[model samples]
Target: MRVASLMNVLGRGWLLAERALQVFHSTARETRALKFNYPKGTFEAWAYMTCMETVSAILSQVSQVTFEDMTSSLLLIRASLWEYGLKKLYKLGEICQLVPTSNAPDENQINRITSGITQQSAGGDSEDQGRLLVATLMSKQQFTSKYLELGEMVIGAFKHAGRKRTACSVGLDMAKFHVELGQIEEAERLLSDMCSLYSPENWTIFSANTISLLAE
Candidate 1:
């Protein structure tokens, strides 16, 4: 059936994004171990660049999805870019170009996703897919004043939808935006709130390992 096929495609996209995340985390750990002694050598630069390219490739693959479909592939790409220290704003511009401006995925679609998933809890996987889409968009948009306006709309919808995890992620995205704009104090406050939402054990360990790069 068409429904089953669509699910399969979305499932594969999620798997690919997850695999890419693992690769990024492993490379980052190796890079960190060599950080202090890493000479400004061509080989070191090449290695770093190669890792970035891998991340970019995976992101591009996720971007191929239609806006109406699962958004998790896109979110994974954004998170991976963030993890790899890619310039979020620049990437946002690239993604905006990929989707037709008039047809770009919007908060309404996001709301549908939130409502569908949170109501059933059986929709957790689908919720993850939707969050990935929002994360991808946020990564591209950064936390500019315009994005902040959009965030307000998104947060409002999340509150109404009752998806606590997605709401927390939207908050985290806002915090990341503040961090990008050099509002370290505000960003830290947002991050503190985010940390309070989940068990410390469930936080992505790979993210903690790459904190230095992400901070940069």
Candidate 2:
């Protein structure tokens, strides 16, 4: 899949490249969920993240990017980060003797630990995963700045391309992430920017949920 994605990317087949990445990500998920025939941890979670990052790097090579492209890329990267952090936390638990070592770690235990990490971020949804991932990184209190820098770089790219709605959406997610880390002020600042991007006609359930989170 890696080679396929790279070949497609070189051929300027962006959609095909993304499809390969999706297949790789799905395989990784199935492996983690014990549905795949591969051994547990056969597919490292960071591999998907790295692939997404690589695609993001070459996005500039495309002369034009549509809304769908930007949104899809955003979702792909978000999932990558979530899986990256989730697997990292589980491995860390094993190393620290906080979790039992087994071929397949308990999913419920992972969920419980994730819940305990951040109250407002509890759930299995992508947004929840994103916030949980950020919270986990922040709780470690290491390389927080680097993560933030990468996030801002992505967000800035969207904004620079005049994809305000997409940029605001990602920024809102990033804010919720900060909220999980108890960075209320920074979260509010980002949330404020989100509000301006929404109108009554264009407001969506996601937008409403973000606002509700801010209200809380």
Candidate 1 on 11-74: residue-level lDDT in tens? 4434444555566467658777877553222222222233344434444454767533535445
lDDT of each: 0.45, 0.52
Which residue segments of model 2 deviate by more than 4 Å? Answer: 1-16, 29-44, 56-139, 157-169, 204-212
TM-score, candidate number 2: 0.48
Tens digit of lDDT per residue, candidate 2, span 118-146?
Answer: 54332333234435343443333432453
Candidate 1 overall lDDT versus native: 0.45
- TM-scores of the candidates are 0.29, 0.48
Considering summed lDDT, which 10 consecutive residues are worst modelled in model 2? 95-104
Error of 1 at 182 (Å): 0.3
